[model samples]
Structure formats: structure tokens, C-alpha cells
Target: MPAFEALQTVPRSGELVDKAFSRAARAGRAKEGIEAQESMLITAANILSDNLENVVTNWPDFDTVDPFYRELADAVCRDTEGVPGVDALRQNLSEVGWASRQIDELRSEYQGRIRRSGPDTARKVRKQAFARFADICDEVEDDLLALGEAREALKTLPDIRADEPAIVVAGYPNVGKSSFVNHVTNARNETASYPFTTTQIRVGHLTRERIRYQLVDTPGLLDQPADERNAIEQQAVSALTHLADAVLFVLDASGDCGYPIGAQLELRDELRERFAGAAAADEDAVPIVTVCNKSDRSRGIEADAYMSVTEDENVSGVLDLVVEAVGHEPELPFDG
Candidate 1:
């Protein structure tokens, strides 16, 4: 699973303000005279600053996030109305961080004034600091709201293990892509919804020679052409460009899947081009192995392999081909 799943809920500005002030009142009641005012100031400042800072810290550093997750986050935000892209998310977090520091500085400055004044004057100084604290919180209210929205959006991402070798199952809808994944993996496919569309991303796993391979079927995102896809789906494809170690392009030659063989070939070509472009920039190429599913129905198409998922024919052979194409070399320990 991606690390974003563990992110804490973002604290709203108003809720944080209320909680800080209420806690400050309790701390003040436990003290006397100028000391009481000082206590209140310290309590409020610490609570607000810590919480605001925590909100900033809780998010994974976008710069250091895995390219797959980072791009996915960017794609998620592009479709989110009123929510800016990844740069904006970084800026908002920076702003909230600045506000938190300002509150801490205000606390130190006000504490000196409270200590130098009489009880009545000290109380007034404390009230003045509270007003500034509230103002600061209000200043970053939108940033806080944006962070909350981002949290809600990102937490919904599928728990994809990035370290494992991933074989992405991609083809047009009803092309037996999901059926192929279901047949190859050990257990039932774990269905997870994509944040951008109602369609789900199904994940299943199989272990070969002590290496676990992840099989993913991205239904709504990769099942269409790049030009025909919306902004959200394009970003999703970009994510896969980073995530996939190999791609299994399934074809339904029978046209029983309702897509023409030419269309399936077109999508396969697009994926090949896309992955080929990515490979040029990296050390290794992500291999795409095309398999014509429902081979029992039709064998007219040219592909790397053939399988009938429904008939359980050559299914394991197709899985073998995918694992071989992935070509993930595991690290060996030093004998020394």
C-alpha cells in the first residue's frame, strides 16, 4: 500500500482554534494573577502551533514520494475542483507551516509583556495575543481546507505495493483482462475503487520462486485511448508508466468483448509507444506481452501468447510469459 493511507486527518482551522482556546481557559483557571495570563498564552500557543505544524509534517514530502504515487497525487488533484495541483498543495503546506511559526513567535513576545504588567494589564495583553492567534489561524483556513480535501482524495488510492514487480493488465473493457487476472493469481482479486471514476482497480497476487508479483487491472483508466480519455484518466496512465514493471495487453479476438480487433491492436500499440518512450529515459524497458484471450472462440489475431480464461486453457502459460517478461532480478546477499 502507498504511504498516503497512513496520513492523519487534517485539522480544520476553526476546530483547532476552538480547541486551543478551550484548553487555554482550563490552563488559566489552574493559575493565579499574571501567572494565569502567562499560562493561558503558553497553552494556546503550544496547542495551535503543534497542531498546525503536525498537519504540515504529516504529509509525505512530495519531492521524495515515489514517482508513481507522486504522479497519482498530482492527477487526483487536477480533477478536484477548487483544489490546485501538486505545486499548490506544497505551497499551502508551506503557508500553514509559516503561520505555525508566527504563532510561536507571538507567544514569546506576548509572554514578556504579560510578565511586566499588573494583573489587569496582563489579562489584556493575553486577550490581545489570543486575537492575533485567531487571526493567524483564519489566515490559513483555506490552506487547511485544501489539505483536508487532499487527504480525503489521496487516502482512497489503492494499496499498491510499489517495491514488488507489478504486471499491469490493460485492454479495452470486457476484453477478459479482469478474468485473466482472476485466473492467474492465487486468491480472488481485491477490488478497489479509483478516486476519479466509479470503475474499480482490481489487484491480485501470485508468488513465483519466492517472488511475489502484483497483477493490476485498471478498468476505466487504461481501457481507452489517450486522446479519448479525460484529464483524470490520462494522469492515471501516467501513474502506471511509473509503476508497471511489465504490461499484459489482453485481446479478445472473437470481438465477443464488443471491441474490434483493430481497436484492441490500437490500444496495444499506444501502450507500447508510451512504455517505449518511458524506457528511453530509464535503464530498463517495461515489456508489454499481448495475449489474445478467448482463444477457444477465435485464433485469428497475432499475439505473444493465447489463452482462454473461460476454458482454463493455456492460462498458466500466459502467466509464465508475463513473469518472464517482468524480469525482476532479486538482490543476493554477500558471502563475505
Candidate 2:
């Protein structure tokens, strides 16, 4: 995943103002006469403009990211009105930059006066410019704060590839979803031991011959009504709906997943319906395979709807089914 470290690292508006002022003051101290005062005001305005603009420019256009990431972003970051997050940020950034340029204009307006006046009067005008700079930064403090929050939320997104054959491992919490992920992919010990224990998405990979499949673990998304899930969980839904090429709906026949067989089945039915509906609605439905797990246990449960895999840690057949469903051809049939 592309990291939002640049957004997270944007300095507070006050910090930028202070840095600009201090740097300008140093430059002024280096020069002599009215030129020093002129240098101070001009440099400060430029710094304020550059720093604030940089903050705006560093943010990626969230609306235009890959489907998985864009949907995930919509889930994590609150969208305003019908406007997308990136558009809103772009608007705020424009305002911030315009205000910065106003500061430059302020410096320009004072240039003639500073050039004509003595050092004392020039110093007073410079102070006035600084004050206006402070006020301008103060005005955009809320915008800065909003950007920071969005960036913070964006940091939690996983690194699942949107273009690959994504195998979204979904089921009720703790149904050996993560364990199965570890079995098939590079993720070992990447999952938790309890229900709702894995909050964010966990990602791994499986490569057979030359083909690679992306494996994703969505924790809080699979076992609930779609309307009832919060925004955070909805992010998982977006990924599953828009990004997944196929889904691995894990079933806990041993009843160790905390939900009863009936409850699990109910959730499964809902998910099946939802997946079918989404695919039909968009004509991009992803195929799902049910894998009955925990065969090592003696719960005496049965899931006869699809293939079954026991605790022996072999899922090559399931992987082959996934590949075939997603329309990918292995160099050879999966023999793992």
C-alpha cells in the first residue's frame, strides 16, 4: 500500500508560520539596511506559501486511486456531502494556497514603503506582515487539522494489490481464516486468536510457478448485516465488493468460531446473497468457494455445500479452484 507518511508528517499551521518567521529573521540579520527588512518579509511569505502548498500537493487524489484503495479510503475517511475526500481536500488546499499567496501580496504591497522608510518604520511594517501571516495560518488551522485526521485514518489501510487475483478470506471471526491464509500465503502468525480480534485488513501472497495471488484477511466485515456494519467495516465491504476476484468463505464446522452453526449459516447465506447481488448489480460478481475447516475436531458438523479442508494444512485444491474461478491459468495445475 502507498503510505500516507507525508500527510501524517505535515507540520501544524502554527509551526509553519513560526518556521517561516524565524528563517526570515535569520536572513534579515545576515543582510544590512532596508534590504534586510525587505528580505525578511519577502522570504517569510515565500516560505509560508511553499510549505503550505507542499502539504496540499503531497496528498494523493483519493478518488482516483485503485478501486480497493479508493473504496477503503471512503470507508476510513468520512466523506462530506456528496463530495469525495480528495475533492474536498483539493478545495481546502486551494483555499490554503490562495491565502498563502495573499501573504505574498501583502509583502509586495509593503515593499515600496519599506524601501523608503527608515529601519524602525520598516521593522514595524514587517511586524504587521508577520501578524497577517499568523492570522492567515490561523484561518486554515481547521483545514490542516482535517487533513491530518484523514492522513491518520489512511495509515491503517493494508497493502493488498488491486490488480492481482485477490482472494478475500471472509467468514465469522476466528473461523481459521487467518490460519488458512498462513497455509496458502506468506502470512504466518498474522492473525489473532479471538473473534473481532483482527480489526484492520491483513494481507499476504501466494505465488505458484509465475502466477501470484493476493490474500486478504478482513476481520470485522464478513459476519454481519451490510447495513449494520460501521464505516470501518464498510471499508472491508468495499474491498470485497469492488476488488476481490474471488472469495474464500471459511466455515467453522467445529463451532470454535463462537457463532453457532445456524448463525454461521445465516451469515453465509446473507453474504452469498450480497455477493450475488453486487455482482449482478455491477455485472462484476466474484465467485465464492466454501471451505469447511477444522475437520480435526469432533463437532460432528457438516457443510456439504462445497469442498472441505481439514487441519492437515493442505489447500492446493482450494487454491486451484480459486485460480480457475478468477480466470487465471497456472503454469501447471496447482499441485501444492
Per TM-score, the best of the predicted structures is 1
In the range 5-122, model 2's lDDT, one tens digit per residue, is 3454667888998899989989999998788989998899899988887777787766566766666555555555645555666667777778767877887788877888897788
Model 2 CA lDDT for position 248: 78
Report the lDDT tens digits of candidate 1 across residue range 23-71: 9999999989999999999999999999999999998888888888888
In model 1, the runs with Cα more than 4 Å from the true position are 79-84
Candidate 2 lDDT for residue 68: 65
Task: Give the whole-model CA lDDT for all candidates, comma-separated.
Answer: 0.89, 0.72
Query: Which 10 consecutive residues of model 2 have the lowest summed lDDT?
Result: 189-198
* Model 1 Cα shift for residue 323 (angstroms): 0.5
- C-alpha TM-score for every candidate: 0.97, 0.83
